[model samples]
Target: MFSWIKRGLLVSTALLSIGLVTTGTDYREVYAEEPLRLSKSVYEKPNIYKVDESEYALFHAVLPSSTDKYIHRDVSSAEVYTNYLLQFAYDMSMLKFGETISKQIEKPFQDEILPKLSEVVAETTNQLTENEWKQVKLSSKPTNGSGEKIFHLYNEESGEDIFRFHVRRDQPPKKGHWFNFHYHTFLDGHEGHHNLGDVYWGKNMPPKWMA
Candidate 1:
């Protein structure tokens, strides 16, 4: 009877160990269930950055400069790292979301802004004759955000070498100040004159009066 009882207790302990392993009841699962992973959606197409790591790093580094005005903090110091992965994940997600909008939707807005803007085309001497003046027109169109206006200067005589300008609405004193964004003279839509890379910061152009 004594021998039988000892064997029964050993068999019961062995069965309990097997049950725990099959049921996935481990300490690691507790932490895993709590959002402890650092995962992000990296947009690699169109060659935004050289490598995927650099793209994410650039986003993380610029995030503070971009968001500091909006999110002011008095903490001694805060470094985003693996320990705060969840919080970092949330912030990083928003950054990438805006990037997607700029790439997919807002970037192609040239068509919408160009047609409505004021245009001025002049002869080689910066002055158009009576008949030549009729060939050129001036117009302006601005979008809602930052009140961005794009200007297109086209000449009827040449009908080429079109100069494009992007002006911001936030000019302090001057309300309708125009600035040059790029100079693209398309060859009848066959070949583009300029590549017009992404405008990360803003219009890297001088003001009309200054230029």
Candidate 2:
């Protein structure tokens, strides 16, 4: 009877060891292969927005390609591409203000706001690929009369709005009305305003935006 009991105990111990080995292999596969599968899904192409269809133009850059042997663009020889793009965005920002308001704040806008805005733009230049560059555009016809949005950097091909610059009339107690320039970005979920300094427009609520 004692010998039979001893044999039963040994069998139970061997079964436990086998179970532990099998469990360990399953966990290893979960840690290693499961994450690999998840990562591949996260980086998959044709990324779709979780928001409304209207927002499809704001974050469509799933994966931009820099290699140009794949697609043909007219500006292949362009060397000052980054600088030109910066200037292009800068020019579009001014156009949104129209001649009347632009003439008033030209110097301040160039001195106070431009440098900071340039820095922000420069930070994203590296992330931009040639594929995105070729399709980039500035949204036309900004809120022409007393509206908030100035313009946005949009990609026609990818349907991504990389950046949005805006200005609003502010009346602070007796401080009068001021054109508060600011911008928004696709990064950080496009939340909060990144101020670009203000231009005083007097108490009379400045002529309707581009008027």
Candidate 3:
């Protein structure tokens, strides 16, 4: 009876360990779905977005590359790109508001908040530069009459997953900029996203708009 009990306990512990390992791997795979690895050579053409002429025109105004002829695969990797952008935007919005809240709610943290925000912003910039984030011509493909195109920011060199920025022909411009860009953490090549929205920093020394 004692031997049987010991064996049962061992079996249960083994199963639990396996379960934990599997779960962790699954989570990692989800984020690594679309790694920034571009198998093709640099000279080889990159994919483009499938969009109509009007949409392509609008995309050109905002994005570095023209969406007139782009190729994009609707794979799990694609989601990774968009996911990065959404999360990045959320982080930035929170950081901006968090500082304000810290200042108002806990006056003691006011001194610490600005420094933390600055450090985060600087880290984000370093990540972007470390990754090969640059403008490149996209591959040619037919639009098939699709009126919209999606753009993704990726760094083939860094092999990091980033965020997605979209372009639509019908959508009106916001805050003067044609397109807005953003990214998440490690999953996203860059650390944060850029908002083309109106921001107020007040009449302080540097101003928030500079950020």
Candidate 4:
């Protein structure tokens, strides 16, 4: 009879907690099953953008000044490697050409130069181990507004440039002007010029870079 009375008190306390068998007014509104109300939808944020790594293109490059951002030793993804390589090249090109020239040359740069970027980046990164690949980085502070120096990919530890990308305004005698895109590799002592093709800008002299 004493054990039965003790069990009755335990069952009564459990029912009183969740408003199912409320003992007072305080417990009446404290039902555990009711959902909490919200002022706004949880997914309604204006500042968020989602990027898909698989379908993503290296169309525009951001965060050019990031320093020594390693690619990580264990990552062997081609998308990760090419995205860094191509985007940095595009970023440097934007810095060199600025708005007007970069827009006009975007077509040729995308078609002609992007292929070379893919080809060369694949070739180079394929030959290296993941540790060596992670050491490679895109350097910052490209020559601004003018000059052929866009940027270079370098070894963060050794501070040596592996590739140098450049652009130059070309005018052959009696020919239309062109913006020439090219790159140099350390293997050739930076002497050999590997062309990435050019965009014709007509007979008139184009505005200076970044103008």
Candidate 5:
């Protein structure tokens, strides 16, 4: 009887140790399988608004290539080309804005915005197969408010304005900051059609004018 009791005690001790080892292994496996968490600062969505023609004329402006009598006959095709150009500008702006936000820098526009913009313009002009007629000129000015940067783009030859971009802080501080940008297309000489609405960044909902 004494021998049997001693064997039972030994068996119980061994089983307990095995159970502890299994529990520890399970815990480690769970920890290894856990997913990594990312902060909002790491990923930001591109908030782009559609070009409103009522506010600006560029949305309906015809490309120089499309102005030929043969191509102009196809009104729908001309409209499509115009829309494509506007979309292109919108896309490039969004890409630049997204990169700027990701860096989370205080004065990104002043530091490196122009060169980056120039690079984008060069690549885009090449892709469009456009000659120097479509070349872009960039300029910036300080706004009356603090922490604001306003940029303007124009046609290199005609000197007609292309677009205006404003980067500013939100009122009351808690709402954060964002970008407001609009595009325009030259009509005759000095006049150009302006977009009826502007695109905004960092907001999911459409702007008041758009809504």
Candidate 6:
């Protein structure tokens, strides 16, 4: 009887360890259970616009003057152009959500908001001219609670990524349920662009659209 009880305990312990290794360790299994369901509807129109040399110069002037060696040499020409697109999205999200939006809302935005945005931007690509940014693609499966979306804005012909945008969102607790958003742009091998700040929407956040 004693030997049988000891064996039973050992078996139970082995099964518990196996369950932890299989279920508790793999993130994919967890995500599968709560599978992200991104909607495919467009919430707002894509605001496609151009940034000429003068506009670019004005934008550049506002950035912090950096004497860093990487800043001087590695800034890509395409980055100068894509900055406008990033700015457009940032401005529009702020206008729609209000001015005090926080980072905490990023999960809801990803699960409930970004799918529609992905569709709108993809559709808008057809209308863009050769000189405009093209082939905008989501770079990876956005993770929940990450507060950001990663995108690769590719060049028209070369298929190379001209720039990538890391768009982050948050909503502070007890802050009227508002959401804040901002993005950092990386030009291929270069560090992120500077001086661009965040936008917010507090207390006046629009109702979430249900599909």
Q: Which portions of model 4 miss their true places by more than 4 Å? A: 1-68, 73-75
Query: Model 6: how far is 69 from its true place, Å?
Result: 33
Error of 2 at 37 (Å): 52
Task: Residues 1-211, candidate 3: write the lDDT tens digits.
Answer: 0011111011111135334222221011111212221222211222221222342333333322332222122333433333333233233333433444223323222222322333333344344431133421122221222222233334344544443322222223342222122223443434444332222232332212102
Over 130-171, each residue of candidate 6 has an lDDT whose tens digit, in order, gives 443323333323223333434445543465554443444445
Number of the candidate with higher TM-score, 1 or 4: 4
Candidate 1 C-alpha lDDT tens digits along 53-171: 23243433223222211211112211111123222222322232244333432323332322222121111213334344334422222233343334344554576434444433233
Query: Across residues 1-211, which tens digit of lDDT does each residue of candidate 5 receive?
Result: 0011111001112135334222221001000111111112311221112223344333223212122111111222332333333333333333444443433432333224432333333333333323433344444232332433344556555665644544433433445334433223333332533322222234332232111
Task: Provide the lowest-lDDT 10-residue window in model 4.
Answer: 1-10
Give me the candidate number with maximum TM-score.
4
Maximum-lDDT candidate: 4
Could you tell me the lDDT of residue 179 within candidate 3?
19
Worst 10 residues of 6 by lDDT: 1-10
RMSD of 3: 22.2
Candidate ordering by lDDT (highest first) = 4, 2, 6, 5, 3, 1
| Sliding window of 10 residues with minimal summed lDDT for model 3 | 1-10
TM-scores for all candidates?
Answer: 0.20, 0.56, 0.24, 0.62, 0.27, 0.26
List the pairs of residues colliding in candidate 2.
Answer: none
Clashes of each: 8, 0, 8, 0, 7, 19
Model 6, C-alpha of 204: deviation from truth (Å): 7.6
Tens-place lDDT per residue, model 4, 70-171, is 443334356444554565565567666777777677666766776676667566556556566656766665675457887777777788777888888899
| Candidate 1 C-alpha error for residue 211, in Å | 24
Model 3's TM-score against the true structure: 0.24
After best superposition, candidate 5 residue 106: deviation in angstroms? 20
